[model samples]
Target: MIDLAKVDYQVILLPPSGGKINITDLIDAWTHEEMEDQISAKVTLSLKNVKREDGWMHQHVFLDKRLVLEATDGNGWREIFRGSVKAWKTDSENHTVHVVAYDPNYNITISKEHYYFKGGKTAAASIKEIASEQGIPIGVIDGPNKPLTKKLYKNSIANTMMERLKESERKGSGKYIIRSTKGKLSCLKEGNNSVIYELDDWTTESSSDERSIEKLITKVKIYGNSKGDARPKVEAVKTGKTEFGTTQEILYKSDFDNMKAANEAAAEILKEDGKPEINRPLIHPDIPWIRKGDKVRVNSGTINTMCIVKSVSRDMHSKKMMLQLKE
Candidate 1:
C-alpha cells in the first residue's frame, strides 16, 4: 500500500480562461509510475478551517472525476461526501494533481484543477461548489440521503427485515415457514401467527402439514444477537449389562431424544456377543435352551449335573458355548 502521507504533489487550478479542467490528466499524474494503467488513487486534500459558501471546509480524495473520499467540518463529520475514483492524471510538468468527482446526481466534474507543491499558490474555493462545478457529486458523508442503486437498496432492506425476523425467532416470538410452488421453494415467516410457512406454488398451497414456523427456521441462525456457538449439550449414557451382569438403564433429565438414541445403540451392542466363541451359549434342537437366571441339567464329556447359565459367549470363529456350573 502506498502511504498517502508520503506521496508528494502540487495542487493547481485552471486559469479562468482555460476550458473545463480535464480530470483524467490529474489521475494520470498520481498513479503514473506506480500503476501500469490509469488507476484510482486515494488522494486526500486537507483544507484546514477554510470555510466555503456551502458552510464547510472540505478534505477530499478523488479517483478520476469520482469522489472516493471526502469530509467536511460543517456537518461535524456527520455530513460528508462520497463518490468513486475513476482515474487520475497529472499536468505536463507533473507538479499538479488533477482529480475528477462524480456526484450522486450522476454529474461528472473536474473538481480540483491544479494542486501546487507550495501551499499558498493554490486557489481557495468551496470544495462543494468546486465539486458541483466540476460535476463532482456532493453528498453527506454519513447522512441518510446517501445514494444507492435500486437493487442495492432493495437487497439492503430485505436483509434488514430478515435480520429483524431472526431476532424475533430467537426470542420465540416468530417461526419459520417454507412454501413451494411448481417445485420451487421459498421459506418465510408470518409475524401475526408467529408461525413459518412452506408454501407449494406462489398460491399458498402447502404439500406438507403446517409445521411450527420455528421448525423451518434455519437450525442455526446467523448474523444476530443469537450469533454465538450455542450447541446442544449431550451426555454419554451407559448401556448394556452392568459389571454385575444386570441390564442397565439411564434416566436423562434433559435430552430425552438423546436418551432414546443411546438405548437403541446399547441394544445393538448387546446383540453382538462380548465373549469368545467357545464360551457362547449353544443352540440345540433336542436340549431345552436355558436363559439367564435359569437352572438346567447338562451332560457333556463326563460332566453331568445341574448348572445355572452364568453367561454366554461367541467369537469370530462362530463357536458357541455356555458357562455351566463352575467346578
Candidate 2:
C-alpha cells in the first residue's frame, strides 16, 4: 500500500559530461508520460519553483542532458522514466525551471529509403532490426513467432514498421505491442498477469462516460495487391443492423497477395473498427508502476472491468496520479 502522506520521489539529472545529480530535494517536478503504439514514449518533467543557484541556467542544461524520475512507496524505488532532455524553460520570477525529455527512440527519425522484409521475418525481429539501425536500446519482445509474408516498406521507415506490427494487433491473433519502458523499447505480447487497482470511496476522484454512437461499421472492404494478383479485394461483414443505419468501411492495402491474407485483413479491420468505443480513464493512484499500455483491473461501484492504461500524469511533489484509461 502507498502512504499518500509520505510518498517520496527521486529525480536525477544526468549531464552530458556523465555524472549524475540527485535533484529530488532541490526541485519540485511533475512528470507526465505516455506509451502509444509505434510512436516513441513521451515524458515531460516540469521542475517548479527550483531555486536559482550559481552555474545553473536554461542554456547550461542544454538539449543534451538526460533526466531520470523515480518513485518509492513501501517497496524500493523504481525508475519510471529515463530520457534525454529535449527542451527547457526558466521562470525568472519564481526561480524555477521546466524540463522536457523523451525516449531515445524519439531521436530516431526515419529517412527516405527503400526497405523490404522477407516473408519469414517475425514482427519482433523486424522491430529489433529497425531499432538497432537507429542505435536505440531495446528490451525483450514477448510475442509469438508469427512470420509475415514478404512486405515492401516505403515512406517513413519507423511508421512502416509500426504499421506491420499493428497488423498483428488488429487481427487479434496476438496482442503484440511495441512500447518503451524507461527508455528501453520492447514488443510485448498480451499477458494474463495484470495490475489490479481497486478504487475506494476515499481514493482521489473517479469519473466515467458512456455514449451511444450514431455511426457504426458492420462491414469492411479490404483492397490488396500481391505479386501474382495485381489487385485483390476482400469484404468481411458482421450481421448487425444499428438503429441509425448499416455502414461499411473500406480498408486499402498494397501488401496482401492472396485471398486468405486479404480476407484476414478485412476481418481484422472490421473487428477492430466495427464496434462502439469506450472512454474510461485510469484510476489514479500514487503507484509509480502504472504506465501506458499496462492493463489494470479496476473495481469501482457498478464498474468492475479491466482497462488498458492510456496515459499517466503525476505530481512528484504531491504524489498524485492522473490516470487515462483506454478500452
Candidate 3:
C-alpha cells in the first residue's frame, strides 16, 4: 500500500525560453480543483520571491508559460496538473507572487468562431475535430456515436462544445463527459471510469443527501418550426404531476418538426430530472488520482453501491482532498 503521508508535491516551471526549471522551493501554497459541469480544471499557486537565472523568479514567470504540479510516494512521479499560466500578480512589497492557470481548454472558453458540421456525424466526432484543431492532445474518447441532426453555428468554442456534448444525451444517447489533464483531452461515457477504487474502510464519513430539486422537471414543452408555420408553435407537451406541482421547462429546437419527435425529447428530460436526490460523501484521506468521473464502489457497513465521483478539491502541499459522489 502506498503511504499517503509520504506524498510530496513538486512544481515545475517551463519557461517560454525553452527549458525546464524546478521551482518547487519557491512555492508557498497551491491548490487544484475541478468540477463536473465546468470546462476546465483550475490551479492556483502562491510563490515567494527567489533568485533565478533571469533575475528574481517573478520577472521570469510570465503569462502562457507552462506550470506543472506532480506528486510522488517514493515510487516515480504522477502529474497532478499541467497548464499554461493564465494570470499572475507580483507583490514586490511582500516579496511574493500569485498565479492562476487552467487546463489547456482555457483558450477554447474564450475563443469564439463559426463552425460548420455536416449532418450524419456524431457530436463526439465534431468535438474530436475541435480538440484536434485547437491542439489539445487526445486520450480516451468513448463518447456516444449517436448522429446529430441539429444545426450548429456561431458561438464560443466552449459553449458550442458543451452544446454538442449535451446534444448526445438530449437525443437519446447516454450521458458523456469531456475533461482534460496535462493538456490531454478525453471524452467518455459518464460513470465509465477505467480505474476503479474500492472504499470499504472507515476512512470515509457520510454527508447529507442532496435533493437537487432545482433540476427536477415534470413538464416539458418543445417548440418547433414547420414548413408553412409563420412562427414556431408547440410541437408537443409532456407532463407528469410531481409533489412540487408543475415544474416546467421550455425548449425551442428547429428539428422537432413533429409531435413524435417532440414527445421523445420531453420524455428524455423527465427521465433524467425525475430523480432529485443526489448524494455525496465526505472522504477523509486524500485520493490524489481520484478525479471527477472516476468510479468508486462503497462497501462500508450499510452502504454498498457503485458511484461516480462528481467533483474534487485538493491542496497541492498536503495532498488532501474532498470528493463529491453521484450514485
Candidate 4:
C-alpha cells in the first residue's frame, strides 16, 4: 500500500516565446486533505500562447474522476476533464507540469510543471482516458503488469471464440467447436467420429477439416508502401484458451494493469501527513564572511538541517552573501 500523504501534484507555467524564465521558480499553491476512500479534487489550469488549430493533447494523472485536474489551452481555454464526482483528491507538494507553446508557423516552446511524490511516481497517461476506457474506478492498480480481468462484452465474443481454439491446442485436445447462430464450426482429428460433438448456438468452433482457418485467423501480416520505414515481419502466438467439451485458443493480450497500479501507488504516496524524503539544493551557498545578523544551519546534510542567511555584500565584485554557522 502507498502512503497517499506523500504524493504531490502541480501545474507548471512557461513564459511566452522569447521570454526568459526558470521553471523551478514557480510555487505550488494547492494543498491536499487527509486520506479518504472517496474524494474529488479539481484544479483549473489555464495557459496562454497555445496553438489553436492543433487538437487537444491530454496528460494522464493517476487518480479518480473526481480527483482529476482540468486544464485548458489555446484560445478561449476549454475544460478537458470532467465526468463522475466520485474520485480521490490530489496531494499537496511542489510539482512540475509540462507546457508547450506553439506559434502560427508551428514553432513550439516547451516548459515543465514541478510537483512532488511520496512512495513512487504516477502513470504517464491522464486519468480521464484511463477511466473512460477501462471502466473501472481510478487508483485501482499502482504497479506494472497488474492484470485486470474485465468481463467480456457482446462485441468481444469473436475474440473469445478464437482464444478458446488456441487453448484447446495447448491442452492437447487438438480440436474444438464453435457454434453460432449462423452455422456449425468445428475442428476435429482425422477419423475421430467418436469425439464428434454438437455445436452450440451463438458460438464458433474448430475442426480438422478447416485447420487452415486457424492459420488465417491467427496470422498477422505487416504491410507498407516504401521500404525505408516499411513494416517488418513479426509473429505472435495466441495465449488465451477456453474449454467447452473440447478446447479452443484465442489471441488475447493482457491489459495494462501495471499502469493503473503505478497510478494508485502515486496517489497513495501523495497523501497528506506523509513526509517523503526529497533531494533539494540549498537556497544559499556556504561561504566564510563576517556579517552581523546572518542565519546559518549546522553541517548536518539531513532534510531537517538548520540553515540561515543574512545580509551580504551587494557590490558587483563581491556578489556573495554573508552567513553565520550554527550548531
Model 4 lDDT tens row, 116-191: 2122222212222323343423332212211223323232322333333333233233322221111112222212
Q: Per TM-score, what order, best first?
A: 3, 2, 1, 4
Better of 1 and 4 by lDDT: 1
Clashes counted in candidate 1 amount to 52
On the 0 to 100 scale, the lDDT of residue 311 in model 3 is 85
lDDT of each: 0.27, 0.64, 0.77, 0.24
188-276: candidate 2 lDDT, tens digit per residue: 66433355555554674665745445456767666544457565544433334354556887655545545576567666665655667
lDDT of 1 by residue, 1-327 (tens): 112122222233232343222222233222111010111112333222233443322223333333322212222222122334444444345344344432242221121133112211111122233334544333321111111111111233223223333322322333332211111222323222222221112221111111122212111111112226765343444343333344333323231123443344334334332211122122221111222323444444333444433332211111122232321
Each candidate structure's TM-score, on Cα atoms with residue i matched to residue i, is 0.15, 0.83, 0.88, 0.14
Model 2 residue 103 lDDT score:
68
In model 1, the worst 10-residue window by lDDT is 31-40
Clashing pairs in 2: 281-325, 282-325
Better of 3 and 4 by TM-score: 3
Error of 3 at 294 (Å): 1.3
- Tell me the lDDT of model 2 at 15: 75
The regions of model 4 sitting more than 4 angstroms off are: 1-69, 85-327
**What tens digits encode model 3's per-residue C-alpha lDDT throughout 163-259?**
8877668778877777886678888776776668776656564444455777788999887765674767776788865887678887776654445
